[model samples]
Target: MSQPADYRDPRSLRSRERIIRALRAELRAGRSLTIAAVTGEAKVTRQTFYNNFDSLEEAGWFALLEDFNTLLVDDIQTRWSGASPDFVGLASLRKIVELLRAESSLSLLANGYRDEAGLTGLAAVMLSEIRRFRAEFGDPASPLAQEEDLYTATGLCGLLTVAATGDASSTSIARAAYALLPEWMRQPRL
Candidate 1:
């Protein structure tokens, strides 16, 4: 017997991409980020938007995390040369600055628009990412490594927050974040 034909719709995928792009455009333009604005900009209906995401803030966070994952997860080896801790930190910061320069609006909107609970949630997410990165690449067996990971993640998040809310350039913010990285990341695994 012949198999049934597959049924799939590409319109939903296209609509999702359009919605994300519209959200980014709104962020870049420093315009109001409302469902109506995003739906209008995306030229997709509210039903389409809701189909993709629950809310505008959810969409923004998804985009921000997606960008960071692309940079951190996809290019881990190339970006992280297991050399001196300072070198890795600087290189990572440089790459982050490049990302921020390319599309900082997402970060700005994600960090700036959130309330206390939202900000706490974002921090927790960032902390989890840092812990995962350490477990994957650094010395997770050491207690010091765990503590250092928390410190570095907290400091970096603070720096990003300051840069997002203040007038500091991303380059400067990255430099500050780089300084917060501990040298223990280069410690040899026992």
Candidate 2:
């Protein structure tokens, strides 16, 4: 016998959601996430937090990813659904940059990861999802060769890191990303 899709106990989901929300709030407030911090924020015990996540980074990354998924639903997935790949890719990238403008917390997540653990496993997973989203939703006029895709993804993440560390306003960050990201995206075409 097989279980149906979307099958999880309500209690478990509520507990996890509380933990994620707590972690997210902490990081957004410019506080680095710690086991103690998250447990206190979530009103959960050390054992409960540990049972849900192996480490603080894992929880942080998961919370960030969940937020990304929501952003995708709000801006990219719904609006750009069924649009051409090129259109989707460019639009999504622009939206992503715009999101950085709108949400300071996202910047916290991006730059925070750089120091918490350089090139973390959670980061790789998030990158993979980003690259996949662009590939699937925003295909270029011409197909990108393997290396080109890698470069584009790397450049985008690197730009995010730079933006995250800067003391500029979200508007300034958005402007710089708008100017630079297009050039980087164009590289694969050249």
Candidate number achieving the greatest lDDT relative to the actual structure: 1
Cα error of candidate 2 at position 180, Å: 7.4
What candidate 2 gets wrong by more than 4 Å, as runs, is 1-7, 28-33, 78-95, 98-118, 121-126, 138-149, 167-190
Q: Candidate 2 — which pairs collide?
A: 85-139, 89-138
Superposed Cα deviation of residue 126, candidate 2 (Å): 5.0
By TM-score, the best candidate is 1
Give a tens-digit lDDT track for model 2, residues 1-190: 1121332867556767888888778867878767788789989888777666666656665666666666556544544445543454455555555555555564455444442325443344345554555564445444653445455446666675566546665455545544544333433221
RMSD in angstroms between candidate 2 and the native structure over all alpha carbons:
6.5
Clashes of each: 0, 2
TM-score of each: 0.67, 0.60
Compared with the true structure, all predictions reach lDDT values of: 0.65, 0.56
